[model samples]
Target: IQKLAGGDICKGRIDVYPKTRENIQVALRVSRVNQLLGADFSAEQIKEIISRLGLKVEAAIKGGTLQIEIPGFRPDLTREVDVIEEIARVDGFDKVDTIFPVASVRPVRIALRQTMLRKIREVLCHTGFSETVHFSFVECEQAENYLSSFASTEDKVISLKNPLSSENDTMRTSLIPGLLKTIQNNLSKGQKPLKLFEIGSVYFIDSQGKRVQKTVLTAAVLGPYELTPWKPRGKEYDFYDLKGALDNLCSHFGLQVGFPANANRSYLLEEKSANCYVDANELGYIGQLSPDKTEIAEKVFVWELDLQKLEKSLPPRPHFQNIAKFPETYRDISILVDRQVTSQKASDLILKAGQPLLKRVELYDHFEGKKIQSDKKSLTFALSFQSKDKTLSDDEVSPLFETIVQTLKTELDASLRE
Candidate 1:
């Protein structure tokens, strides 16, 4: 091997029989030195040491073991330790230590906000709602059409550079679009009266033209409000169903939710279709889909809440109280008013007027006819009155009732029916 590797002494031949023992001793010493240094010993280094004695050495591999083929001129092949050192060096650094320290273990604590969100989901589920998960990415066209205020150019959107499809190119700016798409998909699959909700993140452009991520809880319900075997018997979902759902959610969270009359209009709904509110500073909206947009999803109603605001507003846990023990007083009042005036306005007027004694106001009847003035309609409202600390006599409730009626007349130009 030394001769083939270009070593000088291995170029010539000589007798090695006379000095066999001395050659073996020299080989053992060379192997010890190589092992201590832990370096790969080149054939040139070995041949240089043996050349002074006019000997030749050659390396050979046979039967998976390295052997020294001693030429008659090289006598350094007589030791086993030399072969062992050569094998160890050629095998590389597999013997090095690589063990590391063990990591510490600890229990993970769930966030209070996340726990509240889970509770909300459970409450909805118990109320016959199913949880849904929707993709954040949606079509640019759908986002533009469904969302109230979205960034104009698709390039300004946080869009996928390599989108799977044109329909999934831009990140969703609002949950309504995705929820409607979900309804459309289920409708195609023959599913009806679907009550579904999703709690997840949505992307939008902020005032500074930066993409912002906001967590939101949104729900959509469509088809008949009540299922029935008889054809054309059930009531389709409408604004009232959505209002009830919102009221239930607010009650579950111990939040005070109120809908003031003449609230802002949503892009998705008409004047009679939508209502918006500030639930203790958190804003929310519920409404029927606008007729044109309803073509994408028939008879659907939806609502959305800002989850960050909701988290700030939600109670940490639920509390319970016993029902009122005292007898409750009830009163009914009817107002003949302009058809342009919304039920919400009348309800608001009654509530504001009733003040301390009023427990609730509900509109139960509405009438419109030629006998009724063309510009006027009649609305009947039920009012419940109760005092928390004491049972009230008829006289005690009478004055407050009169005051409420007078206030309605003064504020809303409402007149009591004869």
Candidate 2:
């Protein structure tokens, strides 16, 4: 028991016995109902509306006024305004006047990443590569050997419990393995040297012990893939061919990309692989398919990019640079480097050699045939030199070019091609 405030009497709680209860009455006025609802209803109409409600309600008009006895069952009809609502509802809500609201800005859901993905596909297709798609599920044993973990962990793959078959027992951790399968399927159907690309998700576990996934862009070219039909000089798709397409893609998006010197990967052949990066974040890697992982009787080069990382690298706004209005000087320099050195390494060294004024460095041709030394290959690059402030002459630019060649000579033991 608790004492009452400033009183001698005390109050105590008790469990009360339950019993059946009687109905309570509520009064409603017709004029008050009309004033609140803005719905002028006749007394006869009110009676008819109540009658239509299927209740035996005793409703009538007496002495130039309307009367309605609220039903004890309708707890909502405790107020006269509620009585107005009932009449309006039974009559039809269309009777109420309609009003137009002032228009405001509406949102059209435009996914930027998805839009960019479509553009990437468009660029590749325009570059003579057809887009292809594959199942996220793959053979577990096959995927285990080609796993590329997003997070630095060994136990990163996600396997399915009720997979349709052993082939679909594991979710894909890399796109290259599935892409290789696609290539094999195409080859079996008499389609050789095909250029193909895929944009899809690769699933794995993150560092937080949760399922994580990322969208990746993977491309492959197998056999004697040719963009030009010049039959006299049938060209096979090489590392630089795929690299050229990717470079176009990066230029289209206005992104500055970097390829690392070394990418010793399981699925790629030695001396033919490099990891791509934007800023400090590793985007993905590109290389020739290792012969051991493939049974197809052709040369295959594949590239994959973690588009999730690329998406994050997008700038919120664009930056504009004035095109060099002065006449540019183009230099064709072919350097013969060791067989073990990759074009990307030589390119990096070239960029490092040509500092501020080296506007562009593009590879036009690469050869590794009989005329070239047994242990050396030739790479031809078109170096463009220009300045915003002045027209660069060969006399002024030769020193810098010589410096680049000298650096290559000292660092890579490179020599100018005869």
Candidate 3:
């Protein structure tokens, strides 16, 4: 009986009972043996042993006899001694300890890339810009019309075969259209003067005909510089405000920028915008809201910097230098040229000819009159000169200024006025 209940041996022969309660009579009959032999065993303990031997055993009193129910899985656990053995084995589980293992320690710090992104987010937050999260999927029409050069048939885009709506059919190619649409949606909800930013992935075709992904940081400001219900009048955002924000961002990375006068007109305002460049490579664009684009966001000014390019271009840290110890020499040259001549051309000529002494050149005035030639105008420039070793004098600077004027005159057919 012990061998069968302890799973040490299989029962060689088993007796079949006619009634269901007959198994209980057989179990009680085996328990009498343990009692008569002076072995410590209870009816409950015997039933537990029977359960461990893969049999369902139940006890009940009917006509003063202990009845039992035996399930079909275990014919070996026929008697009460078989049930008692399994109970004794399982009772040892109470001696086992209950405790958890200790975990290992982790180093304290984030990865370098994650740290950089956090700093970028903090900088944007400090500048009154709220961070926004958007889904990659965007409306097809908005993606094509608002985002520049997005193609619907491009395999790079993970399109939805069964889209829930037309608005969420195609994956976003750029962050601008989604942000602008968000601004428009907020405006409809009575939110104004929205200043928002998003840093996210943008997928596009690269020069090598492979699909490339880049992490971009984009920002937009719409409506006024200041909002007040009581005042009812505010200064609207313009190109310079957006340019200043971009300058701040680049300054954080210790970069110096020059605004070229010639900016492409297709995607931005030609007169109020400029393409950003670093080391002669075009970085991005900052511009005022073109009148046509202003339909969605009135008086909006936007700036987007390529984070991939900026990350590669940013110096580790910034350094400072002492201001000039010597006084600067100034030269003013007025050139009379045809109205068709651009300031960019005149500036380029001055820079190319001035060479060694020209520190800076700025156009101060532009005028046209009846006294001048019918097709000509007057353009004035202020040129600054300084030497690292000593202060420059008129004699040392005038000759170089003359060469600059002569170059403009010969190259652009410009003439000195006064």
Q: Top TM-score: which candidate number?
A: 2
User: Per-residue lDDT of 1-418 in model 2, one digit per residue for the tens?
Assistant: 1355565543685435464333444345667656655667766666778778643444544554454555455656755567668778888888865555558888987898877888898899998898887899988876677675344545467899899998899998877777788888888898877898998888877667788888889998866644556633566778877877888898777787778655667768767888888889888888888787887678888888989888888777678987657988889889999988877678878878987788788777888999989999999899988888999887889998999999999999999999
Give the Cα-based TM-score of candidate 2 against the true structure. Answer: 0.76
Clashes of 2: 0
Error of 1 at 159 (Å): 2.5
Report the C-alpha lDDT of model 1 over 169-261, residue by residue, as the tens digit.
988867777677678888899888789899887776655777777787888887875555653566687666677778787777787676654
Residue pairs in clash, model 3? 24-68, 49-83, 50-83
Off by over 4 Å in 3: 1-128, 146-157, 162-164, 189-192, 205-210, 227-235, 258-267, 270-273, 289-294, 316-323, 329-349, 360-384, 405-418
The 0-to-1 C-alpha lDDT of every candidate, in the order given, reads 0.69, 0.78, 0.69
- In what order do the candidates fall by TM-score, top score first? 2, 1, 3
| Deviation in Å, model 2, residue 406 alpha carbon | 2.3
Quote the lDDT for 313 in model 3. 78
Better of 1 and 2 by lDDT: 2
Prediction 1 global C-alpha lDDT: 0.69
> Clashing residue pairs, candidate 2?
none
